[model samples]
Target: MKSWPRPEVPTITTADFQLRLFDTADQVIKPVHMPATGPVGMYVCGITPYDATHLGHGATYLAFDLIHRLLLATGRDVTFVQNITDVDDPLFERAERDNVDWRHLGTSQIDLFRSDMENLRVIPPQHYIGVQESIDDVIDVVQQLLDNGAAYIVDDPAHPDIYARRDATPQFGYESNYDEQTMAEFFAERGGDPTRPGKHDPLDALIWKARREGEPWWDSPFGQGRPGWHIECAAIARRFLGSTFAIQGGGSDLIFPHHEYSAAHIEAACNEPRMAGHYVHTGMISLDGVKMSKSLGNLVFVSKLTEQGARPSAIRLAVYASHYRQNRDFSTAVLAQAESRLDTWMQAVRRADDDSAARTLIDTVIKHLAEDLDTPGAIAAVDSWAAGIVGAKDASNASTELTGPGALVAQALDALMGITL
Candidate 1:
């Protein structure tokens, strides 16, 4: 469960900014919190580690990295936690297909993921948990759900299953705000066995899956079965973040059964009203106009890109060109544009010239980022500043420029944007 090394973020003096995010429930960008008494808690879902990290994965983590940076710059103590669903069906299925050991596959993929994050200069989470390490904790949560009458056990002759009850959690459907029909559609699409024989409503999600032959299992009162997809996140978040946290974020794809059910389970077990202050989702990354995914084998691996003469900094810049909420396409053309932008930025910074506009550039990046993590706008502002600096140097005599602009520009990018240039 150890995390990758974190990049050293520069400390800026300005802290007068309001942080806002697009809350999925409210369907609007709003202030996530005011100055509060406790350290801010954030729980972002981590990867299942069945394959290498792709551009879609890169985009999501980098989006959260921006949020993490601004929150620290704004004088908030943040406790961030993320989980690895290493015991999920995907890993088992992939392992079987590849004719390899499941544990070895998970470990190898996790190592690659850590390498990708470290190469990208991302700030690693404080608590990076794996399901195998937290089996006891997950068991306790399932037990509590069953004892509270919030979940029911289904008698499957081969393996018993536990499902969440819609009647126990008053806010079951509020997070997604979908009609029952729509919820069922999404549920069936995203790993939910809606038509499975069970006592509760069709929408009830699986929290415990009884042991099947050759699958991982843990001993509990419920049965010798692994934790379900949704409940693993619920238990992990509760153990580290308590009942409520500031943000629960992942890809937009998880807005359905995954996040909705996780929120319901926690609300029932902890007797709390909600899971977090805000539920945020990042945009998807696509290729040739098709969304990149593991199943489709259409993934653009970050490791492959970096290995094939692509700068990690340029990759970060490419992602910065699009807002986190908008779907973006990945191609060599996009990478070329980003590399060109990075070249201009490095040229400007290398000059180390004195431009009075450095402080203005810093303030602009901070303000734009504070408002919905506006990465594209922030990158644009930087691009303009770099252009002005380069133009002025070319047009003017070799005059003695101020030192403050160069230092501040370099420091601001590293601090506010996690870009070393």
Candidate 2:
């Protein structure tokens, strides 16, 4: 699947800054290493496509978008690959409930997701692959695990299921440092079944699920069934990004079984200890006070906000108001504040006085962003600069051409934060 078009990011001369990120495993912020001049691999777990794009989804994708933008601005060729979980159980259940063909439902939701990403100016992945298109690759990985004694088959009623042995990899529980009880709880809460009786270990993740009476199936040596949740990402990442990549990122919700199982699967199959050099995750978002989830039917969608005449840049600002690692609430007041900020920035850019403060603001924003993607700090820097500029000058310029120091800041904002004013 092709991604949406790249946004019109302005070209700006930016000094190279050391990008730092908080690794979930280490529980500390550290500087990331980049090659001198080569491709940087990143795989962000995409949406399942059973529902619309919500603020939580927007926040998650935009977190990685910042990383992508900074990598590009610092002169690194990025090979970003994000996968759409089109063949997941949520999509199937939603399709069955709505009485729509699953394929048609998945396609429609994916189209809507693409539209949302475009409106938000998200940098699309170079390889936006779907599970349906990578069935062969999934089978190959499963077969590899089975061949390497890392996977086993469970005899079920009509067909046998494939599962990855939890003990096969030594670094199984290193993804999230949660204890067994907490891990099990998150597993059961986030689309995992720990009580299933047929597995060797309760924590053992499914690699392939045998076809049920009304589910989809593909021809594979293990059974006539579809790929499991963990295997899809591992297979796709390996296929597109070789054995190891620079970063494996997703929401903090996926830190448990999803990331752990995905990493373990690759380790078992490829005979490598680690799959990604850095494990980065975004924070959860809330609607008012409640967490935004599909089951609750309380989602603030991106499309809905855009349809209601919200500025796309304002929406970006609203999401960026808080740091990417900090969970925050989205309310009408939040959007209003972001809109006001956007207006001030636009006004500041059109001021008559060409002050040296603009250059300082550019470096300040880059420094804040490099320090663990400190968006709130960067926004605060811009806010202070804008206040100083707008307060000192009464007569504003008539020209909107992006050529002055103000224009330099504007272009850097567009190029770095995906926030175009």
Candidate 3:
């Protein structure tokens, strides 16, 4: 197997912020200085496009958007690639329930998701691929795995299936820190058919799912089947970025089967030591105390919030107010607080004039964000800066200090966090 060209890793440094990354591979939070001589390859697992964009989805993407902005702000070019699992089981199930063509359903929902992301000012990825469109690439990967004895075809009465043999890949769960029981639980929750008979191991995931009676199918060397959920990302990322890349990121929920299996499949295909150099995961978003999920029937859609006259900026702020790695509860109170904080920041930006103070605030924000994307701390610092500016304005120094610091803070917010004031 020939290895693809790898991007040159450069040394990155922020003026006042020391950027640190929490490497899931090593279970350590350490300073990251990998600057990009070329574009930094970033692959984020995207939505399945089966349902509306919810708060959980918002938080995950916003978390990565923050990282994307921070990288750009610190002078690193990024080639971001996010894959849409348009051919997944949930999408087909939803389409069947809605009595609509699966393709049409996916297309409409993806449009809605794109609208929501755009409204929130989230940067679009350089390559946004769909599984159906990348069938060739996926098929090629599966063939490689088969040839290398990393994958095998399982005969099923209904359909022929190809599974990635977990036993063949020693690094199957390298990215996941969960124990066997916990991993099994999450694996089942996230579409892993763990107990399915004939797999080399219960954890072995499907690479190519044989054609069913009604589901979409593609012509492949294996048979008339569709690519599995995990294989699509590995294929697409490899196609766009190469065998090894800078980072692979998604919601923490994907750390188990999705990310873990994807990494295994990629490594198996390329015969490489690593797929992604770093794995970054964002925390889950819970509603009240329970995790907000479509399965739980407790979803706060982005469309609903926008329809209720809530600003997209406020929604983004609500998600950004908490650390990306910490699970946050969604509530009306949280949204209200975010709106209020955004208002305060906007007012301060309008009145800020102290360049020295503005520089100081920028440095403080950078420091907070650079430390493993500590958004809450960074936001707190900004709130404090805004409060002080407001106090100074009330004390009659408003005319001179307001504009400078205000503008600087606004720019910093936009640059560091994608929060436009």
Candidate 4:
């Protein structure tokens, strides 16, 4: 019998519509279609840049990086934009806690994050707009929201933050599937004090907040203060990715207030359908079955992982070993397994002599990747081909076909999983 043909490229299949794991149950992500010959646009919510980049951060960025790479491999043009939230409430608190200037802290941590991205071989996005640099744009967004009556500045004696009142916008809780009544009840149960001086509603978060003691300051129509944590992304995404883009992705923790608020901000600002076509959120990385936390003393730094002799490629492989949407456990053992698998795939790639068969195998993988990024399934296909060759009852056919499929597998795996040997 003739030997089975290897895949044409490294990708997932479009025919496969596997359930995309999403934290937002009612959230529906529509595929982006571009007039030109490529993907429409992609925007990912970025970090606040305080602590050293950790395993959880790596998982989130790498998952999207892989998605970007796979989209390009499938012959789609992609404009990937990830923002840098350099000014916000969190940055203020962190800077105060450490007795550092807010700008200095933001700059320091942003650089560290860039280094982490470089170390992990995560592709640099075309746009990395920082909140401080984009203050004018954020101000513009705030002004628009105010004009639309979607935002109102009120004084709070207790909290004193300039709030975007929930009562102002009918679409306030639309993204999170919470009606007005539900939102009021939700925040009330959680100790929301709407009557505390200036707040119109208990659920209102800050759009542009007044400068607090020991925090950052930027001049705006509202006051001499900085943008709020959630407003930065909302404004930055509008400036770079426009009202609606291809996909918006980040950690699942951002789903509620961060992402949900961004959705409202965009709608109130632009009167658009949705901020992004699809919403993709990755699950957190856990250490010892607990979510990664510096407070819990279980945070694992990606840089530290390398210092302890973990290979960069292996670290990436360990990250992608499971579905991008699944919660991944960080362990040295799993990383070792990743390294071992790479070695096997590379060995097979090196043995192949036929370029035609290699190309065919690569194309097969590409098809696999396009199917909602079915990486695990794609890896399974490669492994099955390798296993067939090794366990084949026939010798001559095995020897001929094995080399090509094996070589192609390594190349394609690198394209999708960043596994290079």
Candidate 4 has an lDDT of 0.68
lDDT score, candidate 2, position 14: 79
Candidate closest to the true structure, highest TM-score? 2
Summarize candidate 1's per-residue lDDT along 199-251 as a digit string, tens digits: 57888888889888899888887678888899999999999989888999999
Q: lDDT by residue for model 2 over 172-242, one digit each (tens)?
A: 88878788898889889887877776788888888899988888889887668999999999999999998
The best-first sequence of candidates by TM-score reads: 2, 1, 3, 4
TM-score of each: 0.96, 0.97, 0.92, 0.83
- Candidate 1 matches the true fold with a TM-score of 0.96
* Predicted structure with the largest lDDT when compared to the true one: 2
Error of 1 at 103 (Å): 0.5
Residues 97-169, candidate 4: write the lDDT tens digits: 9988877887777777777777677766777777767889888988898888888777554334566655554
Worst 10 residues of 3 by lDDT: 1-10
The lDDT values for all models are: 0.87, 0.88, 0.82, 0.68
| Error of model 1, residue 141, in angstroms | 1.0
Which 10 consecutive positions of candidate 4 have the poorest summed lDDT? Answer: 1-10
